[model samples]
Target: MGLFEDLSRFLETRLDEFLKANPHLELWGLEDQLRGQEQDAIRLLGDLKRREKQLEDSILATAQDIQRWHSRIQQAQAANRIDLVKAAQEREATLLRQGNQYWGQLKGVKDQIMQTRTLQKDIHDRRRELKAKIAETQAQRTAQRTTTSWDTGWAKTSFDGFGRDPMDPLEESFQRWETEQELEELKRTMGK
Candidate 1:
């Protein structure tokens, strides 16, 4: 048998063993386990996407606050309000710091989302490849079985050329010689 067929058979045997060991449980338990893992991965991806969006929103809001603070500082200076000017300056500094922090957090969250997405894609691709390989293995095994059956039938019928009657020793030797010559002729005709 081909490697894939052997592996598929092995997996089938293991599955049977597992089923036998867990006769009281339904087969849905295995399906549930796989579904749980898939759901967890999807949930993780959703969380990452939400976190990324929140981070981006925070960064944009921080940037807008920085701009507002700068405009307020300029207005206070133009109106010659010393106290307001100082306050605006402090607020601008605070907003700038916040904007920097938010930008850093946004970048980090984006990186994390990208990494998670890459991992998910890799896992999905591997699963598809494995499924395709299993299907290919099955096809090969089916073809091999058909070919084997054909060969067996041919072997069983091929000896009909030999007569059923008992022969003298000399005649047996001559028959063997003729059979060898015919085999050689067939080999040559077949370019073997």
Candidate 2:
């Protein structure tokens, strides 16, 4: 599998590009790209898991073989068969060597598993962060557009040639207070 850093950086760049394009698009394309990368990471993780399991089984089998060989050696020694004992000893040594080889392979597999897990975590985190950023940007853009539209609508609604409406003083005062309170609440909620 490719490096997680490289994959995340590539996705980040893609997201940046998508943001720089037409902002009105649905963002499904970028979402699809992220999904594909996530799938690839998952597949690689699955493969590593399988390889780890295979190595574990191999180590167990080798250990069982070593135990059997030790038993054979003990039996030969008890039977006063020196030649058979020596043969069993040699076979035990060979099995020990093979066991060591499997152990080394298992260590390598374990290291690979750790590396892949780290990569998987990093990729998952980056994907979440990127999606959050996209969502934030989209929300900001939507809010700005809504504000602009509302401003235009309000300006169009309450407009006279020269001066403003001074007729309903009580209603005007209440509306003004309500608008002020709403604006203050919005600002507070947005931490602005």
Candidate 3:
């Protein structure tokens, strides 16, 4: 059909062949790899969260420092200390710049956290899908085998004790005698 469908079919065929050849081991290995990827993504998300918190703390501290400097500048101006006011203003400006940088970095870290989470989710979904596919394929193979065996009646049929003629003369005579004895017994019971 379409190119994507063709590619998908090709990949699925190869995957089936690989699975048939290695079965549980290959599937387990792939699942383990996906799990490892998920773990790594989670760890990275943790690190990003930690960095975001640190950045937030740094920004808060900077804001506090800026407020304190503003109050000091007011006090300096009230006391007519222009020199101290100017110095405080410069310090406040620097803190503001540093705070902005931290904010930018925090945003970047948050974006990375989102990306890592998405990657983890994808890995988890892929792992689940692969497991389902493996199980379905295994079940189909088992059912196919069962149908084949049952259709052939391998277990229900046997050639044991068979001969050219299944009914020998003496065996036929014996069967007839047994039938007659059963009939006589049934008749006697009815009479009683």
Candidate 4:
């Protein structure tokens, strides 16, 4: 390889090693973002539930008012008081209109609550998937580190009961020669 290509490879290897030694550095921002999203989902769900309850209560009270006015109109008609009956009928009509409006609003609020709940569930599921992916990545990294350490341990062990150094000089020299030969072969193949 050219000098610049070799330098690039060296830099990349060093960066990988640095990052492997500091696993938390890469995950910090992503973890924080996930936490924030989870919190926002929880807050939104709570707000939607509260609003749904309020709308339901308001709809119930309006329905009760409409019923009360209807009974008053009936009582006035039974007493044969035309003036009182007419006033009660008018009041009942107004209350009926208000009740219909409140019912429509309640339906709209219920739809919104259902939508919000669905969104919350989606966010919750995504957060769980993200957490699982992060855990899987961590487990893979740990396995890779363990394999590397196992290889290093083998390097330190004696081969065939020989009290030689961790790295055999002859093997190192042969490896270097092989690497140079491979590079030369690559260069020749590329017509460099």
Which candidate number has the best lDDT?
A: 3
Question: Model 2 clash tally?
Answer: 0
| RMSD for each of the candidates | 15.1, 15.2, 12.5, 15.3
Best-first order by TM-score: 3, 2, 4, 1
Candidate 3 lands at a TM-score of 0.63
Ranking by lDDT: 3, 2, 4, 1
Q: Candidate 3: where are CA atoms >4 Å away?
A: 1-20, 144-192
lDDT of candidate 2 over 34-131, digit per residue (tens) = 77877887788788778878878887887898899899989989999999999988988988898788788878877887887787787677778777
TM-score of each: 0.51, 0.57, 0.63, 0.57
Candidate 4 has which clashing residue pairs, if any? Answer: none
Model 4, 1-192: lDDT tens digits are 699999999998997787678765446546667678778867876886787788678778877887898898888889998899899888888877887887787788778767877777776777687777778887887778778766664344354445654465566677789999999999999995
- Candidate 1 residue lDDT tens string, 1-192: 699999999999998898677542323444355455656667788997888788778878878888898898889889999899999899889888888887788788778778777766766665566556656656776677768856654222222345433333445577899999999999999995
lDDT of 2 at 46: 85
Candidates 3 and 4 compared by lDDT, better number: 3
Q: What lDDT score belongs to each candidate, Candidate 1 first?
A: 0.72, 0.77, 0.84, 0.76
Tens-place lDDT digits, model 3, residues 17-49: 987786765777788898899889889888888
Candidate 1 residue pairs in clash (backbone atoms < 3 Å): none
- RMSD of candidate 1 to the truth, in angstroms, is 15.1
- Deviation (Å) of 20 in candidate 4: 13
